[model samples]
Target chain A: MSTSLDDRLLALIDGGDDAEAIQQLQTDPAARQRYLDLVALQIMLHEKLEGDAAVVTPEQEAERLKFRALVWAGALAAMIALAVTAWFALTASDVNHKPVSVSHSIAMISDLSPDARFADATAMMNLGSELMAGPIHLTAGRAQVVFHSGTVVDLTGPCEFEMTGVNQASLKLGRLEAYVPPDAHGFTVQTPAGVKVVDLGTAYVLHVRQDDVSDVRVTEGRVLIQTDQEQRELAADEAARWRISPSGLASLEVTRTTARQVLIDFRGEASQGVNASERYNVFDPVGAWRFTSAFEGTRLFSNLHDVDGKPTGISLTSRMATTMAAGIAGELFVNPVDGFEYNATTDGVFIKGDPDQHHVIFHFDGLEPGGKYAFTFAVGLEANNQVAPKIALGASTQTLAPHDKTRVIAFDDIIADAQGRIDCTVTPASPGVCFITALRISYQALQPTQERMNP
Target chain B: MAGPREPEQFVQHLTAHQTRLRAFIHALMADWHRAEDVLQETNAVLWRKADQFEPGTNFHAWAFAIAHNQVRLARLRSARDRHHFDETLADQLASEAIEQFADLDHRRQALAICFDKLPKKQRELLARRYTANEPVTTIAKSLRRPAGSIRQTLYRIRTALADCIGRSMSREAGQ
Candidate 1:
């Protein structure tokens, strides 16, 4: 019977088919369709199953070895570059540029949060302060620098950059977004890998990995990137990557990708109603809870349930729930609401009072040992002038300040115990109202890297 | 740096379809590392032959053809490896899979729902078998179960998931 034939086909697909199953599939259209569907299912199943389980053949092993060698070589070159730079800084006198006074400032610190911290106190530049060519290290929060020529550079810490000149800067670590206007044409950003990115007239994001591999994403206009041996011009929505080999050899690779592609985050908008259609498209979460008034009557929400209408085994405990208008003073929001109606009332749950009085707790059981998980949530202060709340997930606790907008917090790389249970708690710092709109707990998967050049 | 109309259109099409193109190559190669290599090589070729690709045509099909050629070339290079499938069977499967590309998204959604419906034990087992790529024998040894029993359990779970997915998809169509 075809039932037996179907089973046979399934087994064959699992084992990489023999001549018989392939013959059967070639002749019968029904069987062929069944095979296709099952194979698709198999592929989907294979995707869900991750980790190093498959037996690595000799070829794969060789590829892995080659990759490791390249990475090591890149590291060696970065160390060499760092050493050379340090040596030049100590020995070279007025060869590059005239030594400026301590009070001389080539750029002004345009904007920064109150919480922004700098590694070097002397390196901190205020608005309209003349900035000398020196290292600027942002220890925490974000900082914006406006070059004398009008190039606005936003640096997110922990980041390190040096003002080489009024028209030039060098990113040593972390990420920076540079908006180069027409006046700032030829403004250059030198990466640690010795690649110089000269803006023709554009906005671009430059990220320097800890390994010194630099990634540049052009959001608008165009930019020319030059290494000692190679130079390439990248246009809008294009990305160029430069890396140095262990042998001090430099290479570059270019691809067409948006800046958004480099950062992994949830894509769909969160609202007040039940988002039954909002399924996670990229990575699956272990437990997810949407605090919107979508399910108003239900006092208990399960963590294993999908906000998009799928059921799971685990559950989350909510103390109080309510619906409110979008604009609540002191509320902090991470996403923009340009298209959303301001007057509309969205559903949300509140965690009020102090930690000892009332706290929202999420219990996750059966976590994989040695597995890392990310606890993400959308939260905002409901009342004006309320103190920041304390968020506890696993063993770590974070104190968050009160703000008018909603902020999404993602605590990643939290390891689970052998028992697989992780207790997540969110406690308000004061006797004020705080709202949680969305929550998700998912396994942490490493971001995939692009292919690199051998040189 | 904007190029002629053909190159601009090619870049646009390629960028839009990059994810799907990688997925197709992944389906063909099974190994992500290998699929990445093939996709990169295919991208270079696609860019070089951008003039040959029509502006208004199906870029997905054009890209898939190039990826398919690359997959065949890779297979030939690694013919001595014992882990890969027979060329004839793999080709047949690849063709069928490509033909069903239009239905991929719908089937994927159904599969996601069906996956959530599985019992915790079954989910764990499936994860071990699929995610960890642990062989059935190795899993059985770890769990102190017979290899045959473990295999049978996997088969039953797969059958149940397939039936569940079919029902959900049909229900959606009816709605």
Candidate 2:
């Protein structure tokens, strides 16, 4: 192995892939030893650095220093257990045998968005604070309520929510998203008019507006929504909507919509593909772009603007390595939305099929470092079952099929790369058929959602 | 089958090898936080299988076998985002890592002695990257340097640390 073994191993530890370095470690004896040495060094750094994160005050640091040798050898496990034994076994043998305070709190606050406001308190709830079953009203802000059973319910208020059980909750107003692990099976959510959404284990989103309407979209797994009129099972990517009119009657509608679209609709954003004749009515966009034919090889500005309607400095370059042989125009297509009749995308950048040609690549730059973002885009697939198209974002890849003729794909909580770069590639099943129709990106904070916090 | 061992003996063996078992998992999986969770799980299994451990046998080796199985099961259950080696590659690395991490404590001691000698700025950078689990690209952006340069700088510090550790270990062995 070479001297750059250090760099290679460093990169690998940092989540970079190098087949050659891995191969060397497998075949070379000296390299293997060096790699192991590096691993040991990493273990020490992790142990100490993480210990620093845990021991906060000077007293805690002093306590750690008293048994620093044990701490160095990953002794936290043995020491914490020993400490409990030392304190309880010797002093309180009576209760040590078996007696303790019972906790009535069934859930904990996992995350709260920056602007999250609870109706009980006009400020943020501390992350990991335990909650007892009662009403949870949020005047504004988004919060993730995590049940001890491993289910997480994300709520966006002005929402009137009541925690009825460890596995049950009522969404009387605003929006609720439930992410249930298989162990958290039978998790249920109730809406107004006594409609119950019993989840069989899925990641789903729901919206309840003030106008007596509640919409639920199942993004990954199946969702069971039981209404007064009917009980329906919504499969992946299917949506269920309940509307109650002032006549005090409830109505149900089953439709097809992505989680992204339902969220957009709930926010009262302009509907995408709602009117074929009316131009540019899109879902909520921090940035929106259309690959006009005139936008060939030239950089075009996005319709993204601030509250004052100034540009947000987000744009797209229409250079796809293989530019459509000069003077070729964008292609127009009809995008079928289950309930909307007049849904179509105007002219989009069309690519001529070349089997060996590289798929379309777009590098989104000039983003704030460490920001979490979600983006949704539309693709026009000409055939129902030609081949599955692949989309690669960073190192993660997903193969998806068109929903009818047009597919709107959205990915959430994608952490921007160190260079603040988001590279997207759309690979067509057939060479000449793939078309880029539209795309939008939104910024979101992930610390509230992604980071694991203990109270 | 589970066999018989003293509870104190089992706890002693398990805790002593916690750090090494962690290193073995890191060899197969790239995510450090996930590795810690696997280590905890492995410790639980080791406790349950305490009686299965034959007396006079090498405890680290036995513990490594159980830890390897836990890592295998975990990777199989992981969701998208967490990274791991394939089954075949992980198996190969597991054996090698189990063998290599036997003397891990000594290497770790040497690493500490050498790591403390690094400049304050370099140490802080390392803490930011590994402790805070920040990415090199973000660090690069903050430093106003190219991401490649930040990576190279890290590589140099790590290489120097490794060299110092190797020499320290050799000096102690000679004495």
Candidate 3:
């Protein structure tokens, strides 16, 4: 309950009738003291509106946030937190979205997670380690990069990221979850695709793929996403993907969910290589395909239906690869025209390169609607990986290493369509000697109709 | 030597207490311009009563007491004036303000911190209202909002500021 005089006081201050308020102040000592306190506060506010607010951080905790909020020339108040060293190389930029040539260090790696493993290039960045305005490639684990502008970025590897400015960074590849406080409203993350995401005091996660495609999801507050072509605002729980194709830069808003975290791990290099392949069946799949050059028997094993032609839980309805019939080990192997037919004991399957665009589209049906799936596969080739095939699931794509054959990549968050279908695609195929093998699809049902499955 | 330094010391004391003296007068008698007149009159009395002031005494308390007497005499002289207040109320206001003389600095500093916590728009509006001295009606018209809304926003801002300052003071005390 308010002291009824507060209304009278507010009304009195606004040129309303002050007789009641003045009478109350005259009689009640408490009212008089409160009136004086309010009046004093008013006088001070009038004096402080244009001045600086010196936030005095007590001497108790050195790790706690402590900074002086200084009003800059305009509405933008530039705040620098001393949590990191403020050694600004301080060269001015051209004021364009082009990458700033940073001469001095403006940020430091504040902390590393328990399992964080920095790449050999980033080996020197421990706690309180300063970062030059350049690429920080982490082969494994997570790190927290604290900028002098009070923007903190929690980065997970295998990622290539760079600190571009005191309040700015560029996510070239990998995942970064940024926390931009109000004092650091203009904290920016520039993707390799020339898309700049400027924070309006927000916490957001950005993932940059190998194909210059950046996906940004705002978890709190708002952000301004700008490219040379267009600009848009992304609010909380909203997500958009930016891609720089041959045409130009393009952005697409996607259906955002809690799957963003899983996608970050999917973007990481947490691979289950050949050594871990024996344990790959830890999560049972509706169907597992192992493609090989050798044909054990003329048995046609289809994913369409079982004995009674009922719809299977998961079925590869259609697939396409540019026609190729190779005589491997004295047996004729032809690419699938509409369906993949293989023997029960076949080692692997051949995914052909499309003649026109080299894009292999696989429309897998009978999935649980809105269900998240983990599609893990390995590339088995007698020759070196010249194809370097990429697997595309919705807004994310991962490319295989040319020298690595043991590494199995898992796309952990491919959401199925409402019609229980996944329109997955494989792209930019090179004609060499390779086939996708040990391809498995498994997921705990994301809907009520399904049961949770564990690996 | 003490007699020679008396006028200089008195002038320094009067000069330093000018703003606080005016505010103290304003606290007693609501009209700020009238408080100004009373503050000038109080300054003259302090100058005339300079020889009576003991050196190293609480200058604000001594000066504020003189200012309170001047406010009482001014109110007695201006019986027909609109803002003339009750004498008992005036005495209480003067005593309380003098007692809080030490805390005024801390409250003012705390206000700086509290002001920054206000939303940017509210802070700008408050700054414009006080520093630029813009009226609420004009602000409402310019902002394309109702005068009542503007008044309500201003009230809310003031309330937040007052509460924030109180919290800051309490936290400081605890620390």
Candidate 4:
């Protein structure tokens, strides 16, 4: 039982050398038992350390202390407000005046989970309860609020939103979908980015990222976006993204096709295609490749569907652009679906391509020469130390940088060749493998006429 | 499969074992935030698959298995950025952690007793280190002590607590 070995083992564990540590443990039974015991103890200690280490800034600590003190003051203020309202009600009744109530029911909680975690347990949100203007934090689980003016909002957790008024709410953070009917036409949502999105009889999904950049996607009708510097309107299927920098709202981009849905379902079955009449065929692709099979010299992947029992006038020919060593053509494996813990169902193709001259040329047939197409693909990190790979779709090339979270990169309006040859070059950042999933190329359709109107 | 239990009964069972299930997930994942997310996801799955779970059986084991699968799925999904443990290491740790769950209640009680035995200053230091999640460097800077010394103190405290728990468990067995 050398303490030196134990220390080395613990250091190794922290440095993520599990294989070596396990190997050493297997050789010594006593040390293995000791390691297990220590691991259990470590887990308990980590459990106690529930708060994130990176979040404890000096300013945040000071704010927390101030918040604790303000809680008492807030309680006292609430009591005083209650007393004043009661006194006013009694005096007004004696004078034949209308009695005033302290709390106004601004919105009703339409839907919420019973096990949803709330920031304040005392201020639990019950279904159909009239919620007054205050802070509502859904730490976990989704909740919906229906305002008195017929506006309905669904909040996805861990969201924090403050109910400012009957028709207005400031979303401090998180994702929310608001459906404003004609009666509640002027429902407004304020974000931390200083931008206020007012509904003009629309259903819109607003997401406020951790960096204070808000993205609003209008699914139906229109929305009036008002920032401190400028005001704009977003119609149906349009998306507006604006970031709040130190200087104020900067980098604002409004486009009709900024956010596109995955046209081809590559989740389980490979070689799936979008039907011409499908709802998602707005940006229809001539063909799609679901690279299910191995690269055997050169292979052709057919489109999922066929018109009139014949080929769908679209196909993809995959061939090695540059020949490398035998095992360099990235491994094709099925990635399990996240969040669905049970049911070991494989969802999508996880391609781990090699670093250097491992290039694959996808020749998409049946496309007009010089046609504008949007090539979108999702790249994810497969190993801890792996750098995001650089990928080129046609002429548009981008280095997929390592992100804190997984994201999709879309190359828009790239002109294809007469024969529709799209060269996909995968240059890995590091020796480790990078994941490529949900590859799609769609023909960019013509934009509808602008429907901008002054409200 | 047996008929689905009453909704109230199912909820009660879930609530009763929620903490232990979360702890089990945390043990396997080694990331608390990720573990919480997995726990919430598991809860949703449990409710959806309630019919699959037979009543009067080992609900804890069933739930543990689901959580285990969830941890695996999450690891698989985020395999690139996950630095802590690979699938093989996670699976090994998970099996061992589940075995330790048999004496979890006993160990918890022992920990509580050992925690009470610490001095007020040491207890406060533990609270600051653990509950507040303040790094050793931060705590050391505030207390005007070396970071190494603070880490050493914490290591010694944890070792002592582990020893105390072991002694308490042995005493209970003797009784």
Among these predictions, the greatest TM-score belongs to: 4
In model 1 chain A, where is the ten-residue run with the lowest total lDDT?
Answer: A323-332
- The runs of at least 3 residues in candidate 4 whose Cα sits more than 4 Å from the true structure, single-residue gaps closed, are A1-21, A24-38, A41-147, A150-178, A181-261, A264-371, A376-390, A399-408, A415-441, A447-455, B1-89, B110-175
- Supply every candidate's count of residue pairs whose N, Cα or C atoms clash at under 3 angstroms: 22, 6, 8, 4
Candidate 1 global lDDT:
0.59
Residue range B17-136, candidate 3, lDDT tens digits: 654665577667766456556655565445434544678887787777667655654553343456534656666777888875545667777877777777899978886676556688
Question: How should the candidates be ordered by TM-score, best one leading?
Answer: 4, 2, 1, 3
Model 3, A1-455: lDDT tens per residue? 16456656756544455777878887787787776766666545544542432332243122112111111100110112222234323322322333444775566777665456766753577766777787788876678887766678888777888776667778878888888777677888877656888898898888888876778878789878777756777766567776778776765544344322210010001111122222222112112211222122211223333222333456553344433321111011111100111111012334444334545455767677888887765543332134545678878877677645233556877888899878766653455333454455656333221211121
* Every model's DockQ: 0.09, 0.16, 0.07, 0.10
CAPRI-style class, candidate 2: incorrect
- Superposed model 2: Cα runs more than 4 Å off: A53-455, B1-4, B78-84
Write one digit per residue (lDDT tens) for candidate 2, span A1-455.
35677788877876678888888766777776777778777777767675767435564355335334433323433443454335334433222123222446666676665566877773336665667677789886667787666677877768888877767788888888788888777788888787888887798888889988778878668788776655778766567777887664467767652112211110111112323222233333222222223334544334334222334454444456553321111212322321222233322333443444645566666565776777665554432223333567766776555343225666787777787767776565544345544554656541211222121
Once fitted onto the true fold, the runs of candidate 3 whose alpha carbons sit more than 4 angstroms away are A1-4, A13-16, A46-455, B1-19
List model 1 lDDT by residue over A354-402, tens digit each. 4566565555665556667777665543222244446788677776555
Q: Positional deviation of A111 in candidate 2, in angstroms?
A: 35
Clashing pairs in 4: A267-A347, A381-B80, A382-B80, A383-B80
Clashing pairs in 3: A290-A347, A290-A348, A291-A347, A291-A348, A291-A349, A292-A348, A292-A349, A322-A353
What's model 1's lDDT at B124? 89
Q: Give residue B127's lDDT in candidate 1 (0 to 100).
A: 79
Query: What DockQ would candidate 4 receive versus the native complex?
Result: 0.10
Q: Please, what is the whole-model Cα lDDT of each candidate in the order they appear?
A: 0.59, 0.61, 0.56, 0.59
